[model samples]
Target: MRDLPTFDKTEIIRIVRRGYGIRVQKIIPYRHIYRLETNLGTLFFKPFHSKEAKLQLIVKAQEHLKKQGFTRFIPFIPTLNGKPYYCYKKQLFYLTRWIDGHPSNYDNPFELRKAVHLFARFHKAAKGFAPPIEIPDFLGKWPLMFKKRTLELKKCRKNAQKYPRPTPFENLFFKHIDYYIEQAEKAIELLDKTDYVLLSKAGKRELPFCHHDPAHHNILITSTNKAFLIDFDYLIRDLHLHDLASLIIRNGKASTWNLKRCEFLIKAYQEIKPITPEEFAVIHAFMTYPYDIWLLARARYIEKKPWPLTYYIKELIRKTKNEKARQYFLDKFLYSYLLL
Candidate 1:
């Protein structure tokens, strides 16, 4: 793990103790995580860098879910002043009762199945959450986002083509630019064909708040085989299928887009929440977007960052190698499921 910023340990301890009315015996820092051993119990403390309004919405959403009898989510513990977080040195931090469980092991089929079912249950409980805060128009701008990413890909291709003495990274980028651009254009076409606004409007009455980042690491499995979701930083109002697509894409990458594994995941989730045909089409469109490829291209070719361009280029190449399997999976499962 990269070295994280150093903080005044005494100040943090004092803040936690005073704000939450707990006795913190020790504070162990692991990367960006602060594990506190307190008289009340073990607490996990992490930095809250998001806006206060967003943080408030997250806290309120968790409270709403908990009130709806969803015990699997960890709610933010309020400070002594009834605030959801404590601000020190212009940085916000929040605490939660530490779960004595590891992240769900995606490699284990049984655990993976459980995680899928648990996610569907979460969607069910998260329905009807209307945060007072004004949610962003992310769904309304879906096509625009895809178009912007496609433009970025085009710019990257142009830059790579014009470089007289291109680096190895540039060469690899140039090699696959055509394919990536094609995939991106195809994504935009699919988005144009989808009536996302109508779908969103149809579900407005019971619009589900999605866990924007529902990767396996955010899923906790207790020693007793119970599963819980952590990390609500990116919670937003969207189709629950957004969460499902995120799960399948991330897990499919781990298995090199294993068609059987992807099918199993969809089936496992369906057992809890059956997906309609139209919803399946939306999911397929989302899965076909090649988000990872676009991100890598932009990071390596367009953006200036501390990381070496070689690293991003290598990732792009790795993803490109797995494209065949991903395409096959999409054709076999997504198309067949949509009856297209």
Candidate 2:
């Protein structure tokens, strides 16, 4: 792993004290993070990846949430110069207070329900957020993107067919390519039937933003069962159902593709904010899509993940271990989806 910049101990301490005005007792490095044991407490310092203006937009948007009495977001600590970030040798860095919590347990029913409620509150609070300039707006991109992925899956199937010497992974991929491709196409077809294709308005009132990455790590649960969302880096103005679909996929995969668990998550979120019938239909399109298996194939065939053949085989098997239940889950969700 790469260390931080080649700054010595004195230079590092000087940088922190001058820019952030905090007296550091020790500087600890863990991978890409610099943990500052300061007089204030434990703080995390890291180099900001995006542009300064984008960071400003994030700060303003998050600060607005805080003003609206939403306390779930972790705000960026201002620099000594009243900026959310600092520039040293043309590299950007920022600091924030650390959360002393572990990753949320998907296996815990209580924590998972809390996570759903947290997501609902977050979406409701984000209703009035409107950035002045265009950022990473993902509204209306899903339908077209889904169409493209379907075609990409078809191309992978062809490539696998022509391999002079196919590996075990390729053979396994070829075996299931038809099933996943069929699901991808079905997802696209179902999306065409929804109101998602006709969405024209792009304002915050029409479509609220979603905390795009809802993986286990990004969500932290404290002893009080409070959920704290750490990273605002991937917030996008998209359908809130997109976020719910992601949560189901992230958690449902661990539950052996249990349909009842997915239903419970949806019901919990609806207790806070009811899902409209139209949004419910859109979510069905997202949930039934075989995104995980398609992504695994895309990584090996399209993106060319440079790993051993057996490694891909192992991951593919693990991802599809409960395939029989995946089909059942899909059928159960599809029954209600057709009634919609």
Candidate 3:
């Protein structure tokens, strides 16, 4: 609905000439994605940008699976010119086989259980799949963001008197900066310089394929109970616990069954591939990391990155109020897993 760059109808026609019909649809980032409806079938046309490198990594990841004969995913193919993607009017475009299924955001407990079990199975299946892609370094990004926020908050405090009345989170925000930064630093230290989680301490075996972004919304459930995970954008190798923690933080609270549903999902995932005692120990700590991420997200708004300051403040207050959940997990699970 917002203003988008005009695309070439000729390019759309070219692809359609090859027996696919073209219809301009939504413009999405990462890929100027288009929904192409052809008489033959419907599929997605995605043009890569500066993001081609990440997509290339994903494509390379598919090679590992293809060699082993897994076909659950449709990998990106290189064009005849040896380019993994195509360019059109200064924009890039590639096509993917459209997967038919509904996105289950796990609003219901049953769906949440299904999604959790599916992720566990997917991780287990990718255990032997190997790729040559280097894991991205997240340590620097987090610290840079934290530092930027600290400075911004400091500056904001200096001008605090200019605003007639301080918002509700105004006081709590200052009080928690040091605490959040300390926790953020602790997490950054734990991240090793690697492409994936070293499942093997000797750095021998790579951790299972991580969906990178493991929100419940990315899951697609077929009528037959099969779940297809779409979106490989954030796929990286990291501690399997990272994915678990992401799922818990982003999707756990949204589940209809609340704590009961979350417990069921975790238990189901454990049954498919048992989590190690060592990994289990830090699960609580990992779960709490999202709160830190949330703080950073809020900071982005406060820094005037297009997010509304009022909404961000409201969310900050809500997350701060939710600290008890993190503390509960720490008291109950962190002690059992990490401090044991």
Which residue runs does candidate 3 get wrong by more than 4 Å? 1-11, 15-32, 68-70, 77-84, 127-134, 137-169, 175-204, 207-209, 255-258, 290-306, 335-340
lDDT of 1 by residue, 164-262 (tens): 998788777777778878888887787677777678776687767888997888889999998998888788778888899889898888998887888
Reference-based lDDT, each prediction? 0.82, 0.79, 0.58
Candidate 2, residue 15: how far the Cα is off, in Å: 2.4
lDDT of 1 at 168: 82
In TM-score terms, candidate 2 sits at 0.91
In candidate 3, how many Å is residue 315 off? 2.3
TM-score for predicted model 1 compared with the true structure: 0.93
- TM-score per candidate: 0.93, 0.91, 0.73
lDDT of 2 at 241: 77
> Model 3, 12: alpha-carbon shift in Å?
2.6
Best by lDDT: 1
User: Model 3 compared with the native: what TM-score?
Assistant: 0.73
Over 1-340, each residue of candidate 3 has an lDDT whose tens digit, in order, gives 2355545656565743432233434333333466665553566666555455676777776666566544556555455565556665456567766666777756676777778877786666655545565656332243354356545544555554355676555566666655555655554444332222434342235445567788766887777767777677777665556678778766545532246555676787887878776566445545544455345544553544555667667766766665556556545554544456
Q: Write model 2 residue lDDT over 58-122, tens digit each, in one string.
A: 77668767766778967888899998888887778888897878888777888888778888888
Model 1 residue 319 distance off true place after TM-score fit, in angstroms: 1.9
Q: Return the number of clashes found in candidate 1.
A: 0
Q: Tell me the spans in candidate 2 whose CA falls farther than 4 Å from its real position.
A: 1-11, 198-207, 336-340
